[model samples]
Each structure stands twice: as C-alpha cells, then as structure tokens.
Target: MDTVRETTSAIKLLEQENIPYTLHSYPTENGPVAAVDVAAYFGYAPERLFKTLVTSDHKGGYYVFCLPAEKRMDLKKAASVVGVKNLQMLKPEIFEELTGYTHGGCSPFGLRTKLPIYVDHSANNWDAIYVSGGKVGYLVEVQPKVLENLVDAQYAEFTK
Candidate 1:
C-alpha cells in the first residue's frame, strides 16, 4: 500500500523537501519484522533494503550507518569510516532517548540530534531503496541520490 502507516517527522521532512517516495507497511503482529522478510514481501533482494544501525565511538560521539539488512558491518571498516579507534553498537535501550526512535525503527531522517550518517555504497546500485519510516513495520522507498541528498549522508563501504 502506498499509504503511510503513520505520519512521522521523517515523512514530514520528505514532504517538505518535495522528495518523491512510496510507503509500504508490513505486518508487525509477530513483533519486529526481519529486514529479509520485508524485502521478501516486496520480492526485492536484501541488498536493496537497508537497515539503520547506530554506533558510538569510544569518545562518546554517536554515528549512524545504513547497510543492506542481510549484510554485516565490519567494525574495523566502520570505525575507520567514522574515524574512530573503537566503534560499538549503541545499546537498544538508548536508541529512543538518543535518537528519538526505537531500536529497529530509527531512520536516517529527523533524528533528535545531528549525527553523521554513512550509507553503504551498494545503495547506489539500486534505483531506489527502502528505509524505516521512522517506525517499525513501515518503510519509505525513495531514490538513493535523493535520500543521500536530504540527509547529507556519505556513501561508503562499511560492510563485511
């Protein structure tokens, strides 16, 4: 369905930016939906569906990474990409307070705080990609260029 499951700051920001997008809502009755399942529902390769991951540098600074849902983040590469000696996933409990979004529901847009966002370079292989609609069970599909432009995200190779 093209209907948004709900309006979020992320969606609002897209509307404000005039970026074209489509919304897809997946069933969440079974709790958080796996990224693969979401991709399968739309008959897309996992690489086309990116998941937002949050990390913290040893120095307490936070960063966001977006990679294919099925791929793994190489800590060394991730740390280097973010210019950190040590990179750790932010604890699930801290996601909401720190980013104004819950675990598995954070998007690169409309964050509570400004954070450097890095998206996997693989995203460019797709004409468009899906990201959390700022909430679980909802996704927004938009051109990767537009997504990167709107969020000021850097494209990098951080996947293993």
Candidate 2:
C-alpha cells in the first residue's frame, strides 16, 4: 500500500481523529485535469470521485458543494439549499485566496475557515468516496460519513 509521510492539514486532522482513509497519488499532467480524468486515471467509477466546489451568494457568504465528478451542479438547487437567492462559482483566484488551496486541490477537510458544506445525496449510495487531498495529483479515499462528520456537511440533492 502506498503511504504518504508528509502531512497536509487535511491528512493531519483525519489522522488525529483516527478516521480510516487511503491516500492515492498520480502523476501530474501538463495541463488542467478534471475530476473525471482523475477517476479514469485511478480506474474508479466517476461517481465514486467527487469534486469540491466553492460558491458565493450575492450577500458574499461562501459555501462548499461536493458532487459526483461526472455531474454538474444545479446552481438553482445549490442556491436554494443554502437559502440564497443566487450563487456563483467562486473564481479560482478567490477560492485559493480564501481556502489556501488551489482550484484543483480544494478539500472540504482543511479550509482556512469553516464554511457550510453540502454534499449531493448521491454520495450516500456509496460506502466510500474519493476527494482531493488538498493538492493536485493526490486524493483521499474515505467513507462518506467520515467525510460528512469531518466537515459538518449536510447531504442534499444539489446536482443536475
């Protein structure tokens, strides 16, 4: 089994809580890589891999949403779930600035601050799911409940 000795804040917190998880590493590609691509690279179903998205309401409140790699977030549903009139995806620059992790590396686990997180209901069907490991080219496999508890996230139908 592959293990990472270096600790990211996300990994450290998981370890401290004794949550069971597995670390996965992949070679970095030359250009942008999508979550679906990562899933394919790891030989996992796209639905088992999730992408963490940061969004902001018109009032400037930040929220996080996790959905299957192959699905698109339903903006209207996402806004409704968060009780906002509207939501816009946070710009890459703003996301990195606020979360301290780049676009492809954002994990709900160890953000600079605690933001409300909403995971798509579909994830509940899986025993475990994969999410970014706070960096590009790395992923963490963890039980959905473990991830939900770690981030205080709620699950809802927020994907199209």
TM-score per candidate: 0.94, 0.94
Among residues 3 or more apart in sequence or in different chains, the pairs in candidate 1 whose N, CA or C atoms overlap within 3 Å are none
Candidate 2, residue 39: lDDT: 92
lDDT of 1 by residue, 1-160 (tens): 6443588878888988888988887777884478888888778889999999999987889999999989999989999998879899998777899888888789898888889999999999999899988988888898999756888999999998
Q: By summed lDDT, which 10 consecutive residues of candidate 2 come out lowest?
A: 1-10
**What lDDT tens digits, residue by residue, belong to model 2 across residues 41-135?**
88899999999999998888999999999999999999999898999999777888888788888887888888999998888899999988888
Q: Please provide the root mean square deviation of candidate 2 (C-alpha atoms, Å).
A: 1.5
C-alpha lDDT of candidate 1 relative to the true structure = 0.87
Estimate every model's Cα lDDT from 0 to 1.
0.87, 0.87
Predicted structure 2: lDDT:
0.87
The TM-score measured for candidate 2 stands at 0.94
Clashes of each: 0, 0
